[model samples]
Target chain A: MKKYNAVFACLLLVLFTNSAAASSSLEEYFYASGKIKVVITVAAIVLIGLFVYLQRLDSRLKKLEKNKIEK
Target chain B: MKLWLKILCAVLLFYALLSSFYHPLAPGGLTVDIEKLVPGANTFVYSGYNTHFKDHSNDGLQFFVSSGSHYYPTEIIEVIDNNHAKVNVVLPDTLPSEEIAFYANTPTDGTVYIMKPMDISAFVFHQNYTNGSVPVKVANDQHQNFGYPFQVIIFESIRNLMWHVPMWFTMFVIMFISFIQSIHVLSATGRENMLDSSMIYVQSGIHDRKASASAETGLIFCILGLITGSIWARFTWGAWWTNDPQLNGAMVVFLMYVAYFILRNSVNDEEKRARLAAIFNIFAFVLLVVLLMVMPRFAEGLHPGKSGNPAFSSYDLDSSLRMVFYPAVFGFILLGYWIYNLRLRIKILESNEEI
Candidate 1:
């Protein structure tokens, strides 16, 4: 869990710095076509977040089974 | 949790995912280049979004400048492209009203209109002025195509309806399950003595595990809903977090549930911890209902279904949107339940190991 927090902090730092840089072309790409890329970005965030949660649950379950076998 | 139900959930989710992004928006008026209307011949380039103007140019493409009940026909001087047309209309010396609306009709796009505040100071407003000499044909038929309604500023981001809304709905369902389990825990404990047999305590423990597991799953969905809603608010409402009553209410509910977990972890004794958490869960659920459901309706907020703004049911959630939205809601609820089921089993297993 601590490792995941560090990873999330690093990801947020990168995102903030990238937005602060003001990359016009990247901004233009997202703002094009009535800002449809905004929807895409939102969808990506949801899917990634859910998948990460599923992975955590899977690992925790595996760890429990390993402990049971060790006993 | 059955095989068929799981398959149905997967299929419904797949359909919603594909259709929400794949469907196009219905053609609607975008803008006109002219800012002001004059007394004589007025020409402007009319532009439309997803409209087939050029293809239907020969199909009796007509334009009208309508003020009140009178309609003055305009000539389509040029068909510039599929979505652009040059229109010219001659205004009379006197008009019934200052507010004028432009209308374009085609067999494909039906009747699309734009009513923007323009400078009509040049025309005189005679309330009884009527133009009976000019033949007016106003086609009131709408486009026969099935597409999401085109809205200004919201444009294509309206597709987020499928993803963002269902997250809250799923959270609500999961939390309600948690609420029910918490009630069961309280009741089971109430029926027995303090130092009861191990079997009754175990039963209450199972209920406690189920309650916390469901709440944990519900929290995941609530966080997802918040993140998606924040992104959507940033793009549409021009702010990541608004002072809307509904938004603040959601934040409070989130923090309250977090506090519920803290209350659970603080008490080491299983019976005491379960009773305390169950009582807190009941209060949290009531607060959730009040904050999310009851308060938003009475307060003025940027979200739809508020005090002043029209609800999505009245205008926005059209037939095309309902096709995907209902499936998405059901799919997300099933997915949430599936996750809650797994978490409950894991919690039960971990507790049994300790005993």
Candidate 2:
């Protein structure tokens, strides 16, 4: 859990810096074409978040099944 | 839970995803370049978001300026392009009302109008000025196209409705399941007939596991809903986070549920933990209702439906939107249930292994 927290913190730092660097262009890109890119960005976030959550759950279940076999 | 239901959920989601992006937006007024209308001839460019002015230029394209009940016709100088037109309207020296509105009518795009406050101090205002002498042809035909209503700031981002709204709905359904399971956990302890205390403990333990599993799933959805809503708010409402009552309420609900998990984990004894967490869950659910449902209605906020009896106005959930939104809601709720089911099975297995 501590390892996961560290990884997430690092990921957030990278994302924040990257966004800060290209904030102007990113805002322009999202606002252009009647702000359709905003919708795409939201959809991408939902899809990726759900996938990541499912992957974590799958790994945890795998660990539990392995422990049961060992016992 | 059932194979058929899972397939139906998949199909509904697919349909929602397809239709949400596939449908076009109805033509609406975008902007009029003129700042103020003077007494003499006023020529300004009119731009539309999704309209065909060029195609209908020679056809039935007409423009009008309306003041109160009187309509004054405007001459179309030129159709610049499909979405642009230069219009010239001559206003009378004495006007009935200073409140002026511009209207554009086309064969394909129907009628789109823009109302802007004009600097009408230059023109003398007469209450009984007869400006209705000229016979003006106003096309009352609605836009024939079947599409989502085109909102100004929320143009294509309106599509986010299908994705963002369903997350909260799904969270509500999952949390309700968690609430019901928590009630079972509390009630199981009240039975007097059970001679074996171990039996009650086992039964309540199963309910506790189910409750926690569903709550976990509900929390995931709640987070998703918050993120999506925040993103939507940024572009439309000009901020990622607003002090809107609904928004603050949602944030509090999220924190409260996080507290629920912390409370569950802190207690070591199984029976005591279940009993305490169940009571806390009941309180959390009640708080959720008051914060999200009851309070938002009374307070004025940026979110629509606040200060209004219904959650959404008729214009917000038009027939075209309903076609896609209903399926999206059902799909997400089923998906939440499916996730909760899987999580509950895992929790039950883990608890059994502990025994």
Candidate 3:
């Protein structure tokens, strides 16, 4: 349950960080900057999603190992 | 499961990644320095983005003023730089409106046009060259081989179609596979209950596991798709999220799947969870079709294929784009399937108490 809460907090942090970066960069940068920023944001999202997915899989594997040890 | 298929997916995606970045945007759009024009000799400085006007001499460049379908030739005064030019446009006796479109053409850039009508505010200006209707002078229609379409605003962002669109397409394919698996699980359970035996329940559990695994992978792709889409929207539409129908529909579909996961976690019994989730999955699939596909077409939205915007077919993905686009679609779909397959195997191992 604590792990789940931490994951949710991390997700919220990512969401807020993304929105803040998007709004600030648009105001700060010119035309060409927009493209680079967009590419970075997209790549970041994919990497984060994959990371979270792997974390879930790791937790499941841990649970299976715990059950095996108890038996 | 096959090594060769996984290798192929990796190779195709690598090719797509390389090609999307390497290809350059074709030159287009003519920007004018002046906003207003008079009937007599008027000078307007012209420039373009990614244009090859510098390659052409004063003789090679042509300017024209177009009102409706009728075009009147303008005299080119000087070719200052490759990107910039000075034009002496003599106003015609009469224009359709107070504002008229100006166009510039080069052998390499084809025709770069500025459709923002420059206001002809001067009362003394009149076309004295011809008494009758002046025939529109057509510019040279020379095509340059740049290997990509050059739209005005979309410019370089056209490359995102390779990465962003395929994510959604791959997600849809995986979700559809999940939907099919869910149906099989429900039917298998139905058959077993009718026979008054728990034997078929084992088989149905496997199907249920596969279905859930597919949905899990599909959700990952969906999240990636939405994130990429939002980034694209920020640059193109000047907002992270718009009130567009297609965008809203996609969000709703994503939310529906989130609810599915929540529902699955709430139910403790394996058989009951599978049965309930399978029913919900079928309902969600139907809603996905309606929200993402059907409803967007009828309403006005900023997205392509909506009422106001032009669909993908209108632009016509020329041979150049199709070369990379088709491969990207195939690669992403294969990759998605591979991930789902791996997840399903893990689920099977878990249920059997195997490491």
Best by DockQ: 2
| TM-scores of the candidates in the order shown | 0.92, 0.93, 0.85
Name every residue pair that clashes in candidate 2.
none
Flag regions of model 2 displaced more than 4 Å: A1-15, A18-25, B132-141, B308-313, B316-318
Candidate 2 chain B least-lDDT 10 residues? B309-318
lDDT of 3 by residue, B12-97 (tens): 98888777777766666647888677666668887776676668774467777665565667777777878777877776555554
1 or 3, greater by TM-score:
1
- In order, what lDDT does every prediction score? 0.85, 0.84, 0.76
Listed models, DockQ each = 0.66, 0.76, 0.38
How far out, in Å, is residue B208 in model 3?
1.0
Over the full model, what C-alpha lDDT does candidate 2 score relative to the true structure? Answer: 0.84
Q: Which regions of candidate 1 fall more than 4 Å away from where they truly are?
A: A23-29, B132-141, B194-196, B316-320
lDDT tens per residue, model 3, A1-71? 58878987988897688557886654345247225455555655765776777777778778877887999
Better of 2 and 3 by lDDT: 2
Per model, state how many residue pairs clash.
0, 0, 3
Clashing pairs in 1: none
After superposition, the stretches of candidate 3 with alpha carbons farther than 4 Å from their true spots are: A1-30, A33-37, A51-71, B77-80, B97-99, B121-142, B194-196
Per-prediction TM-score, chain B alone = 0.92, 0.94, 0.90
